[model samples]
Target: MTHPHRTSDPGVRARFLLAATAWTVLVAAVLVAVPLTFAGRLPDPVASHWGPSGRPDRSMPAAALTLFALVWLVVAGTGLVGLARARGEIRRATRAWFAAGLGWIGGFLIGIQAVTIAANLDRDGWSRAASLSWQVAVVVVGAFVLGALGRLAGRLGPDDAPPERERPGPLIDLDPGRRPVWVSTATAPWAVGLGVVASAAALSFAAAALWGLAPAGWSTALPLALAGVVGLAVSSVSVRIAPEGLTMAFGPLRWPSRTVRLDRIERAWVEWRSPVQVGGWGIRGLPGRATIMIRGGECLVVRYTSGGQLAVSVDDAETGAALLNALAARKTA
Candidate 1:
């Protein structure tokens, strides 16, 4: 049998693509028109960068800057649209977030371009351009406000019906008095290697700061150290399944963990998945699904009674899924 929520709908996909295309075209038009409208007033070279003191430090040709901004907006819009389309039938919340993100980026670029033009209006040269600190701040704030509005607009339409997919595997035979538990660990050696490299770099920077070789090295070292810690944390996770349900702990400390109670689980199944299928590695939150991916291959997928699903990549996913399904069945029976 197939679940209604998991079935793909063509209408939903078409609407998303159409909306995305319209937004992209509209933003592209604004970016192009604003500059050409004020071409006579703007200097040949416009101020594109400002130093810490708010003085224009870098300048680019007016035409080139406009072209660059348009290119950037198109690329970003296309990427967001492609990702959404690739996910097929997605949840309304996810679509809203994606729309808001695209709106914010497009608005931000357009606002910055407009501000730059205003700053350079009737200027003798790039050096005489007005300081844009306050104007840039206004643009950022306005972009965020527009993004929130876009999110609301995106949610106005009806939500797509859940897609259709086959149900979980056959139940396992279990003794009435017996309790079975499954445990496994998933790890990514590449992530661990990256973490080690980052840690090494952080230590080098810290030593340089201590020796007064690079006085501001601490600024760089702190962020690197934090990234290293995060990489290590996500490099491995321990998964446990028992009569109580499923529990997943990240890293050796297991401080940050997630648990799904047996009562909430409606079904369990094993599916082969890759990183690209659910965005890149790490913890991925999609439309109606959440994935904890390490080295993706066979993933144990759990569907909650509330219609949401979670998938985790680990060894012996078939056994883990079968055992979990049996436990869930027992609970319901």
Candidate 2:
């Protein structure tokens, strides 16, 4: 009872696009309007960064800050839209989640801007701005609530199920004394490049901050480093199928890996999977039903007796699937 990949309805996709765009625009408008409304009261240079003591250590022109925030929001929102559009056909759940993400990002950015403006309002100088401890918490919680609402809004249409297409893999006859192993690796060059660039940027930022060139840059550096690590982690993976089960080791270190015990496997198959079918690249879908899509093509799909399915894109998937099926059968026998 496997579900075939399906494309979302045009109307539904368009509606989501419209809703996401509208939400982004609305948040952008608010981001701009709030500053304009208090233009007279805000300091020339608003507090943009607060240090560990909750004091403003860095400042930027109010107008410049507003513009930067606006551009960030626009870029992020547009990226989400572009990703959705590129997928061609997207699952309803995936589409809704993407839309919700757009909404959440916009709202969160807006909230941050709001907090900054509020802190700098009526201040004689950026140094006098209030602390953001409580305000930040409120913004995070509010953004999460808005994101949940956005999810509901995006899921307005009727629920449609994808077509069912079950494919059973071929089994190979092997001697009881023989041991077989299949190994392959999946890599995404784009992800690797992005990871390297982000990591380099983080290092540069940290150096600049350490040298007092940009004392407040630590804030930006931390997130960039995190993103770099995540990008690298998903850039490449080594997949191996052996008598023990199917194992996938992530990144160069191969420290974090997942294994599906041969005994737990109900069946295995080779499927042609696209990033769109599994909600873009990298690790996607829920824990039970997940996909590791480094590139779009043949994937080794393993279904567990508990009904969970995991798909990993790799070369020579046919052989891997065949071997897995044969091993599972032998274990059962």
Candidate 3:
């Protein structure tokens, strides 16, 4: 029989716990694994020698950084799922995740200090302090970046898809339950597309630079770098339901817009991007996996979830919920 308070399935009961436990356990296991394999503790001393063994090690700590990253992702997912299920725990769960982030940063900083101490038995105070400061730059800067991503995710936080929103009255005559229309951004497609192109172009330029092909003029790489900076700053665009087909905004950033017909929209929803396989964010599959970091949970991959998903990052995600609800209604009807 259907439940009373909850009209729809709330999904698994221990979802939150499961997500949290899985992450925490994974980190603990890794922390244990690191020291065992490295034989030398993390943040190994910044070496001054050229010998492979004596070189300042970066790979280990970078690998270990995954622990902090995994924890953040798990917590973020947990927080989002829980918040969707019930607002009662939003604040509490958010705190736990935030603290987890800070804790990870703190632990990383400590690890760096430990490395310093282990490497130098009696380094002068200034030396140790100076070294530690550099470590902070790596750890803390990354922490803030992740924090920004988290904030964006929170901004797109989901709400209970209004039960009635799905079911419109007969007057609309369109599908009754059909709700939510994918919306678009105002930014130009070029701006957003250019950002992606810019990222690739910048990487290519870097490769060129490494090959000693750095140009002496603006064409050398300035345009590519400039484009990338603009692209990153340009924001992303999206298409929601519309009379024509779907309305697309250039980005969360205000810009020109385009409305493509629903006929053109091949498909939608989150999926592992690249060789496109519709699945969860960061999900991997037969083809490959998503390269983009979908901090905003539940990305709407408009068009077929195949062949390099369009990176139409969006905002005011209530728009997405509306779009999904519309699609669900249409599907059910």
| Clashing residue pairs found in predicted model 1 | 4-162, 5-162, 5-163, 6-163, 6-164, 7-163, 7-164
Candidate 3 on 191-257: residue-level lDDT in tens? 5577788778777877777777775433646688887765655445445565345565443453465
RMSD of 3: 12.9
Off by over 4 Å in 2: 1-10, 29-41, 50-57, 67-71, 78-89, 121-124, 128-138, 162-165, 169-181, 194-231, 242-245, 253-263, 270-288, 293-298, 316-319, 326-333
Query: Which candidate, 2 or 3, would have the higher lDDT against the true structure?
Result: 2
Please tell me which model should have the higher TM-score, number 1 or number 2.
Answer: 2
Best by TM-score: 2
TM-score to native of every candidate shown: 0.66, 0.69, 0.32
* Model 3 stretches with alpha carbons more than 4 Å out: 1-51, 55-93, 121-183, 186-234, 242-333
Which prediction has more favorable lDDT, 1 or 3? 1
Ranking by TM-score: 2, 1, 3
Give model 2's TM-score versus the native structure.
Answer: 0.69
The candidate that wins on lDDT is: 2
Worst 10 residues of 3 by lDDT: 271-280
